[model samples]
Target: MVNGDDNNARITNGNLAEVGQFPYQAGLNVSFGNSSTTWCGGTLISHRWIVTAAHCLDGAESVHVYLGATNISDVTEPGQRHFIVDQSGIIVHANWTKSTVTNDISLIKLPRLIAYSQTIRAAILPRLVNGSYSLYEQQTAYASGWGRDSDSSDSVSPVLRYVAMPVMPHILCRMYWSGAVSEKMICMSTSSGKSTCHGDSGGPLVYRDGNSSYLIGTTSFGTSMGCEVGFPAVFTRITSYLEWIREHIPDLP
Candidate 1:
């Protein structure tokens, strides 16, 4: 009730994300009655910037980026595990459309710079990657969030969870989604049955290159069959939005 939406859910067939393992993970919370609730996930791309799904920002009220927590439920407890702050600026993609979901990404700016620590860090952008491995088809990538653990369940998990899924060809993904799999998107899934659900929206789809993690996509949407199904879940491709990202985060390297 304190961290996640009771009506929607997150990662399915995934394991818990240990403390500090995903320092860039964040929860996008909004006022719900007398309390706040996290309904979506996001990635900290810089000290003062976070990237999330455009749909998560549109039409939402009193929204804030909740970060520094591996387990968001701890916020509800007497002790603190996360930090919540109002966004200083928000940039929803100019091309974003609710009907087609063409540009389903947004940039959120914080008022102050976040101090770096084990549980809080910035993500590497795909353009800045100079690593041994660049993302490619069939390569494994990871997604982490605290959405529901089951597709049919309405309860959202309080613990951070993650799934390692393989990136697939857009053509292969088009087989499942038809016209919905746009060039601005990338698809990920596995025969092992790992995927994301509703509450996982706006979370980063990360690729590991050596010790650093690069953000390649942002959670967008999935099939109607739900998260547990082998259906390829589509994400907003980060690489395609580099120019837009730099337009907002001008100092980004």
Candidate 2:
């Protein structure tokens, strides 16, 4: 179930005013109990570690994580709780290719620890593991979820939408995804129509450095037809997986 249109529009909880105002926003609402679903975009790099995608937990099972809440039914209570019981069953990316989108990436190990409030913190990885980030570099990238703003209906979005893309040029996104765009991938867009559609798969593509906010990428797919003009919204290049994400989350800093 992934359907919600108007080009997936509904991210207005302060409308991204140049990406400042932070108030706790990390995500995950994946389900697999009723009959197939989606929305697994995460980031909260530590406090118990979380970084998502791996095909949204591939088969799925009791996976429910909803922090802070831009409005996911106001998130019930329990101090904006947390849970990650998916064990480590689907740790993909040995050169992953379920059809081809290269190593979709995943990691969830959170049974407890996320208590960082100010919203709820943790997100800052990419302090120059290598170099190069200049597509003019105006820098202002953030992505939130509750996926499916469009792609003809799978229904998932109670409220929690965000988009501020701008960070393009991986050879112009491989000239519009020719050769399926890879080099570990990283590109963003938004002619003001805002993006990150189709259940915002494994979300979190942040960037904002003077106050702190850096998760490199993970939303991972795009071009279902429209986020507006010629498609463009791909990710999963968290510094080319920084040493395989510190050799499979060895307490990533």
Candidate 3:
């Protein structure tokens, strides 16, 4: 969903994102009950693999990834390109629990290798030494998705959305959620009124360093109250699970 006020923050809001701006962004289309569809955001880590949140996979069926997509729900819209590709496996962390939402990271395996392009490519993963990410206080990052623009209506944006995420101290962030925030997670929000909402789960929280953009975390969960209230959004830190990820996808780097 779009995170900020469109009237003032239109330039940085998710609703106006250009096509292929984020080459690694992945859009998920899953079967719901009979005909309904649910979408979740993720990032391509390799031609055959995706990294996302564990919660988004619960009860998912007929899953597909809209690769190289910017306008996910648009078919006739020009200047946009996408491919609804088949997915074979949905892998969740063994330690993931719905109750605590810990170990919320997960992976998706595609049956065939994807064709890379400017609009479709794998994401960069950081090399964490000794389990600590080198993020500093107040560091700003980027997150993209096609989640809701507002909870007023349960709708996902047709175009990809994004926001600048300012890293908040875990200790400071804990105050917003009654200490439910964990070390395995990172908390972020934008003073410009940007925050990740529904449908954004499993999306990548990116940090741009020089010419490279690294997938630093995966969207996990947020306050139960709702998404538009500026509550600190939580993410599963990738640095903590670098070993596990490497074990599963040996050639991820």
Candidate 4:
């Protein structure tokens, strides 16, 4: 979904809701000077850090982050100011692949620590040490973005859109992808047309375990069939990369 006005030009089959409007949703816009280039989805994992897909960065510098915003067109609010990332400390997964979407996670360190607020904060990362994640069958997860709503369209959404899907069994997912789906990936989808899309890359796939919302995955890729046909949507499992994430940001739990 596109997050700004219709005239902004870029479009896809994804959607986005305003920041702070949804606790599990966050807006990710990459702006170079006066013009906003591309819009990807992200999850606020801390007061200052955001977790997204590495392919979204694609070796760009001097990016601005917008928090506490409901609409990309409207950024005049007090808490919705853009912050510059500390380029020196930025880290993208060393094994990230451009051809295939593997190890697609990256972290952005803000120059200054963001003050905790209702509109901006971190989401919990799933625990890697947890006994087992395969015990559940009906595990539901949420994904938000501003990409296209369907495969046929390029027009992005003005407001963020969300969809709930069930986690696909690892065995089934691996079988479909010829075991390409690794330990670092999480698969999700529905039997109907309900799932994330092309521009939803880097967005969070969140699920609730016990009392907290855990970021289980980051939107990566899916088949050309789009969100239909129950094709598994792949994501970078946050739990699999917890050590790498924490090594860069020691304060994150």
Find the candidate with the highest TM-score and give its number. Answer: 1
> Across residues 6-45, which tens digit of lDDT does each residue of candidate 2 receive?
2122222214221223333556656675676555667767
Per-prediction TM-score to the true structure, in the order listed: 0.87, 0.32, 0.86, 0.82
Local accuracy by lDDT, each model: 0.77, 0.64, 0.73, 0.67
Query: Sorted on lDDT, highest at the top, how do the candidates line up?
Result: 1, 3, 4, 2
TM-score, cand. 1 vs. native:
0.87
With candidate 4 superimposed using the best TM-score fit, by how many Å does residue 192's alpha carbon deviate from the native? 2.0
Model 4, span 1-253: residue lDDT tens: 1121221111233345545644545556664444446667778887778888887765655556766665656667655657666456457788988666678888877777777676766778765355754422359887777677765676556566777768888888888878777877888855566767656678888887665778888887776544554566778887788888888889875
Candidate 4, superposed: residue stretches over 4 Å from native = 1-21, 31-36, 77-79, 128-137, 209-211
* Sliding window of 10 residues with minimal summed lDDT for model 4: 1-10
Instruction: In candidate 1, list every pair of residues with a backbone clash.
Output: 9-148, 10-147, 10-148
Give the per-residue Cα lDDT of candidate 2 at 248: 80
Candidate 3 residue-wise lDDT, 1-253, digit = tens: 2122210111123446776678898888766446667678888888888888877775555567777877877665443334443334777788888777789887888877877877787788986657656864588888888887665645778888888868888889888778877887887874554777777888888888786888888887775555666777778888888899889999876
lDDT for position 233 in model 3: 77
